[model samples]
Target chain A: MPTEGHTGRKIIYDEDGKPCRSCNTLLDFKFATGRITSRAALPERAGRESRTIPAQELIPGSKSYAKVEPPDVVELGNSSWNLLHSITATYPSKPSEQKKAEMKQFLTIFSHIYPCSWCARDFEKFIEQNAPKVDSREDLGRWMCEAHNAVNEKLGKEKFDCNFWAKRWKDGWDEN
Target chain B: MPTEGHTGRKIIYDEDGKPCRSCNTLLDFKFATGRITSRAALPERAGRESRTIPAQELIPGSKSYAKVEPPDVVELGNSSWNLLHSITATYPSKPSEQKKAEMKQFLTIFSHIYPCSWCARDFEKFIEQNAPKVDSREDLGRWMCEAHNAVNEKLGKEKFDCNFWAKRWKDGWDEN
Candidate 1:
């Protein structure tokens, strides 16, 4: 029962079932990279099974996996780990185009109301927790109104007063 | 001179002038739940005069302040240290829309290449550090190509033969 294994650089198989690459300690092929190669090389099961193909294969009109131009491998060792972590940690759950547009609009309109990151995050959380559950735009509007009012009350000001004041004064309001 | 400060539910002024609101200990004001009283309350001189505006005036449309709304005030209060750390560590740099779009595109493509969080983060860091400063679309394409190549080499297959490949393959050799 000879099994294959990897010793850092190249794939190797031992005749005496040794684990340690240098001293030939009894090896564990269960965790060996050669095990992966053997598993991959196993004969395909009979019949056309619905294969859970890699995402690359799922992409229509994609060429054979062997022929495509390879991504730069130099950075792949640690770069892939970095890329995946950053992407997932910061990934926004998929949203509709309309919702994204709305989010952007709100971000712009409420930009001043939330000058600090904490406040902005709070507002975003409030929207996420409340907006989707609401049934109608009217409800959404009311929620926003209440939220705006709540923030205003906290800050000791009336809602929409800034806009009103800017309109009335018409002279000194700095355009953001 | 006593300065008025709001302590949760009540407004209190510091009579002792003991730097109660130092740059670091100003989390109370930073995460305050007050309404935006007036953007006008912010002094124009605040922006021109200070590198960091007083935490009190960071309201939207204010002369020197901007507002940030977060989902929860309590978490904000507790986590203010980390948030402030990020604020102070990075210079205020606004990414262009083009850069934003490219980043988004890169993330979308990168997600498929390295689904694991760790791998994705590493890849993103590689791009951030090594990719050319993207001022134009041409630069973005070049960076994408470089990123693509970087990931391909890591899996030990000829660049672009793995499960997460991204290059387009031509049809002469494979078909024959």
Candidate 2:
């Protein structure tokens, strides 16, 4: 039987009956499926760096693959946010009708097909509640910042102040 | 007058007549606009870490924002590739018709509004030449790898072997 995820939604499983890798944190999936050999072997957290198996353990000719661990939920989220924030940072202050429509459509499709089922559902709900503000760069940046803060809060991370979204994502911090 | 970009596409400018940050590399934009007073001040490359202004230069109470530099073309590309590969890594081996359609739409829209105008155009052309294969996880992963390798070749970077795409993105390298 598939396990109930913390989100109260039933966690999805693959055709092989394995818990969906993208939909659950690595440790939670391992524990729920009884893959962990012992409690002591549990990682401190599901961080990419912490879990990366050394390249020496890999097959020959794979030395170049060092530190290239498959992403867990946290790592994937971090990379996705980096791309999302950067995209908005460079968005035109005054976008054309086509640009605005494309951005809106991109976000909608992204929310629907994101690999993490539960996380995607949460984001879809968030978008429904706070529609994307794509009229201008500033509006979109602030909206993205707020959206990120919502995720941060859910993940128990620090919330970034939306006022500095532009500085953080665009125009580098002032030097001198 | 706005400068011609390397891709032969006219570089876009914002309403302020400034070169679009997302359309050209930071150093290229700076140089074309004569924002760089001296060639010696030019960065080795448009890397996020290479050009991050120290937190000490930022406003007070912003020390926590260290290392959060505005992304340049290279940085944005790196993050975007990470997200794209990870998404494909977690894709279902056998997807529903709805899932396949959604994935295709997501990639098409992504290719349209990918922030970097020239890069987006190149990706759009690549997609036109090689339609996204969404029939299975393996198909999608290979397609994404080839797409990334196309960009890598264009940028003079080493190509990743597609044979190990699964090991690099889906399963961890074997340990012991």
Candidate 3:
């Protein structure tokens, strides 16, 4: 699971040298020229080297499909944060012990199965270090905010006002 | 939890008249005034109705805050579908039985905790009828495609060509 922002490249070779289920693409894995670093081997000059390429590459006759695409980090971060915040916002206020256990297990499994390799690793490390707070809604919500802030910090983005979780996820802004 | 498109109205209330943690926004189970048919009672002339008043109402100066926000179904659906598709696209081809079991359990729990009440119910029903096929990567991926297609049909969207799971998710196009 190569993470985003890594300069090193990884290969996904199949024993039969066949197309893999990695996003259903037939990645040659090794460059046609014999190395993972060759630019000429790519069907699209992917902006990122994550294992699964974006689906737009599969579209026919789309000349600039690769150029306009957002980098993997941006898309992954946006999608991940949106889902995670929603989950936290919906956490029970005073969850039962079983509920708490289920949530913890969910996070652990989520980290393992998450799509991006490096992002998943980072999440697992964060969970190990901070642990999830599932006993109450408030605790889980705050922990989620903190977890997101940590990612933001890594990406050099400004911290969100955690108090505004309700506004950000549950309520529309004042103008709305 | 109200689903999308019921009289086009959504409901977010619990039987006990307490917020049921469907995404954690505090939905007043009933309106200040009665008559479930009063669209005029809505703060924002909501396109659909579900209980959670948007947090804008809680802001310091929002005298009319509760009048405007619709329930969170649309956003949740968009976000959730994006992530789940991604997850299935990247599933391992030869998953172990334990891995399969975990995935099934995860979906069961996910349905229960999902924010919208009616949407969750629909999902549970879908699972009960179809059941997940996590025995192999292909089975699970196909199941995911069908599950998503079910939602798409409800929303009146065109059915995606399920054959393109690899192309849509794992691989870029043939040119890639």
Candidate 4:
């Protein structure tokens, strides 16, 4: 079946002497009704030829052929993932570097208060895991809550006052 | 109460000479505890004066404070209310340039599909109304689905197809 003009001919091609590819009919005459009116059957000799062609073996000039290059692989110490992941696992991406550094500085300011070794370790691990997810500086409130809770749980301390976390993060604890 | 330390000596200043800002009690020795500690109460005169300082104002300076800058005003032009509304809205101070570019590109592509007509007006309106709340590129798919569905309904066309949207995007039809 012919499928040349699915949505009515809208003058896609200029009217000179171009033949329609599907119908193989001359499209030189302008129709008074402004509609496609001609249709043609395949020529006898043209109908005998095999149309199937393997895609890979087809002409290099064909649109379907594309030269794909293999992706680059980077080795990270023992295992290989990608350079970005390695960097992030170690430190953080450039965008989050500031926040990471702030957390480190905040840790430094409050270092004296966190006397219990276990509490400190747990707090660091908790912050490292959660800080990158913080979208805004205000999100530090949530981080402090989680860190305080984690530390208190680790040290077997009764729910440490939330004020300790909030005050330390806020005041930088009398940097004198 | 006597806020001072041993020997009736003002415990405010201990042998090591480190005074606790909170209680004004002299610290005996310093240790790198690596965690926040609670300060003991200080003498009335000093403690009352210091407590008045706001915690938010005392946070140590970080890159967030240094880097945060006001956003430039964006002007909306002839487009869907969604696109216009998104353009006119304020974004976070630190929105990544890539994100803004992607938004601009999406709007550009959308403009081509809706073109300069009322047909795309609803999509523009919808996007503008919703863009501020969108946090990531993945969220855009949902917005597009809803916006396109609304536009299609308004135009009396078939339901918007994601495949068709992708094809139109790939073909660069809406880019113009």
lDDT of the candidates, in the order given = 0.34, 0.69, 0.58, 0.33
True contacts kept of each: 0.05, 0.39, 0.11, 0.00
Off by over 4 Å in 1: A1-176, B1-115, B160-176
Report the C-alpha lDDT of model 4 over B62-152, residue by residue, as the tens digit. Answer: 2111111111000011112322222222222344765555454445434323212233355567666756234543344445555656755
Supply the TM-score for candidate 4.
0.19
Candidates in descending TM-score order? 2, 3, 1, 4
- Candidate number with the higher TM-score (1 or 4): 1
A1-176: candidate 1 lDDT, tens digit per residue: 33433334222333334322211111223234233343334234222233445755443444324232211111121222222222222223454565445444433333222223344455566665555323333333344445554555655754533332222111122231
Report the alpha-carbon TM-score of model 1 versus the true structure: 0.24
Clashing residue pairs for model 2? none
Could you tell which candidate, 1 or 3, scores higher by lDDT? Answer: 3
Top candidate (DockQ) = 2
What TM-scores do the predictions have?
0.24, 0.64, 0.59, 0.19
For model 2, the stretches where C-alpha displacement exceeds 4 angstroms are A1-67, B1-59
lDDT of 4 at B34: 14
Q: Measured against the native two-chain assembly using Cα atoms, what DockQ does each of the candidate structures obtain, in the order listed? A: 0.04, 0.16, 0.06, 0.01
User: What overall lDDT, based on C-alpha atoms, would model 1 receive against the true structure?
Assistant: 0.34
Q: Once superposed on the true structure, which residue ranges of model 3 sit more than 4 Å away at CA?
A: A1-71, B1-71
Locate the minimum summed-lDDT window of 10 residues in model 2 chain B: B20-29
Q: Show what share of the native A-B interface contacts model 3 retains.
A: 0.11
Best candidate per lDDT, number?
2
TM-score of 3: 0.59
* Local accuracy of candidate 2 as per-residue lDDT tens digits, B1-176: 54664324455564456554333444445555666645456344325335655767654564345535555455567668877987787677899998899899889888876766667889999999999999999999999999998987875666778888887775546441
